[model samples]
Target: MKSTTSALLNRIEFPVLLAGLLIAAGLWGFVELMELARAATPHAFDTEILLAFRHAGQPDNPIGPLWLQGAMRDITSLGSTSVLVLVTTATIIYLLLIRRPAAALLMFVAVAGGKVLSILLKFEVDRPRPELVSHLVNETSLSFPSGHAMLSAITYLTLGSLAARFLPDRTTRIFVLGLAVLTTVLVGISRVYLGVHWPSDVLAGWCAGFAWAMLCWLAARLLQRRKVLADSE
Candidate 1:
């Protein structure tokens, strides 16, 4: 039994082990954040962070230079549905062009399934958008989990993992993964800064999105294993 366990552990890559732990951590974080979101008023931390983006008691007046607000809006749009769709479609097409149909399909499933899951989670949480500050953009969605944060994490991380597989070295792989994480963080922060989501909303979204992306990676790994088995047979 010990030998079997050792063999199994050896079979799993370092990234796979790390992903498993992240999945658990993400789920735990989401559950805890959900409880905080259920409160009638935004948490002190949530309100404070949201207000930090604005100028002294002027919710409409965002902090930083005049150009910053516009830049932030553009950054936030990187995670918007239209942009994500376009990126995903382009990636899928590229994968297909490279004759990697399975990879293309997995990418499609990860992003699409993540979207469906995000919608369902929003409905389940039913938290309203932050009323403590004026919204910088128009958004009417239920706001427990920031959709932009969640979907950005899902799409970017999934693509990062996929791209890493093709990259030649560990440094390049890490860089790709880091960029994915950085993009996810930037999107989440942008959501809160815009007052379209509370800090907790973005936190929960990050947790759930990372978890979902890791789960899809694991699923793809399993499918590849099955294909290997079939081929061997």
Candidate 2:
């Protein structure tokens, strides 16, 4: 039993272990948020957090300066469908040009899968946008999970992880990954600040997005190990 346990532990690398943990945590959090989203009433924390972004008794006016609101609009655009599609297309083209068809294919699958998953979850919960505050930007989609937040996490993190593989050193890889995470986080926060999503919606988006990205990474890793997908040259 001791020897078998030791062998099992030895077979699990840090990356695999970390990805497994993240998948578990993300799925758990997403499920909890989904339950809250299905409730007839908004969760207390969701309303409280959404309200915190707006001026007291003035849901129409956000708490920040006018310029800050503009800045948030710009930041939030980084997670928009248009921007994400452009970035993903450009990355895929670059990968293809560099003779990394395997990586390009994986990238497409990861982002496209995330997009579909986001849409399904949105419809599944069928939650409406927060009416507690005025939306700084108009959004017509169902709002259980913010598409911007989920897609941003998927695209940026996938791109970041792929970039890290080719980076020369650990520090550079860490920096790229950190930037991806920061961007994802900022996008999620912007959703709440703009009054387009409840805090739980953004949180759920992040959870689902992170899990999907990590699942793709694991799939790619497995394919590479099996020689089904070529590693970066």
Candidate 3:
């Protein structure tokens, strides 16, 4: 019995350990990107990309409607606070209703904590918004780590993971994850298109977002294992 329990603990701990290592790696990668973005002087490539991204907000682009523009703008304005509070409340209610306190708590922390980490990274990097082109939409934050990209990744991926719980097949699970990733990518692109962020900024956001999502998934997996062990006892 002791050996079996030890093995279970090892299995359960693996994901958390992996996540911690990944988070550390992500932090290093984000720092490296920041250094590169900062050290490189603005070039023609930056100028061209900035122009193109800002152009996306123009009336001529059929891909983006006025309403969608308005929505993205609104979401960007919420900063990190909106998602944190919303996810927290929702997770609490969900846990209470479903009687899965561990899972709920883990989800809440993963989402909420991701938001907080995003903010800290933003301040730490302090990369200015692009000056090569004028912004079509309103934006007033540091541009290195795109907030919309980060939040969309966290929120969508979290929800997708939860959704996958009900899905039995591997294909369905992959589909859910793909959808979450696609949404995150679209949101990041929209930021660039609206001239609110640079392509490099979006790239950094993607890296950071991916890293954070992996960490959150790791936490959730660990929580699930704990629940499984509890049930066994």
* Each prediction's number of clashing residue pairs: 0, 0, 0
Over 72-188, each residue of candidate 3 has an lDDT whose tens digit, in order, gives 665554334565467657766876576766556656766777778778878987878876655657678788788777777777777777667769998999999899878777777
- Candidate 2, residues 1-233, lDDT tens digits: the string is 99999999999999999999999999999999999999999889999999899889888999978999999999999999999999999999999999999999989999999999999988888999999899999999999888998999999999999999899999999999999999999999999999999999999999999999999999999999999999565
Q: Which scores greater on TM-score, model 1 or model 2? A: 2
The per-prediction CA RMSD against the true structure, in angstroms, equals 2.3, 0.9, 5.8
RMSD of 3: 5.8
Highest lDDT: give the candidate number: 2
Q: What lDDT is obtained when candidate 2 is compared to the true structure?
A: 0.94
TM-score of 1: 0.94
Candidate 1 Cα lDDT to native: 0.90
Give the higher-lDDT candidate: 2 or 3. 2
The positional error of residue 150 in candidate 2, measured at the CA in angstroms, is 0.6
**Model 1 per-residue lDDT tens digits across residues 1-233:** 99999999999899789989999999999999999999877789888888888988798888899787788899999999999999999999998888788788888999999999999999998998888788888998899789999999999999998899899999999999999999999989889888899999999989999999999888888888788412112
lDDT of all the models against the reference? 0.90, 0.94, 0.69
Once superposed on the true structure, which residue ranges of model 3 sit more than 4 Å away at CA?
1-29, 43-45, 54-88, 223-233
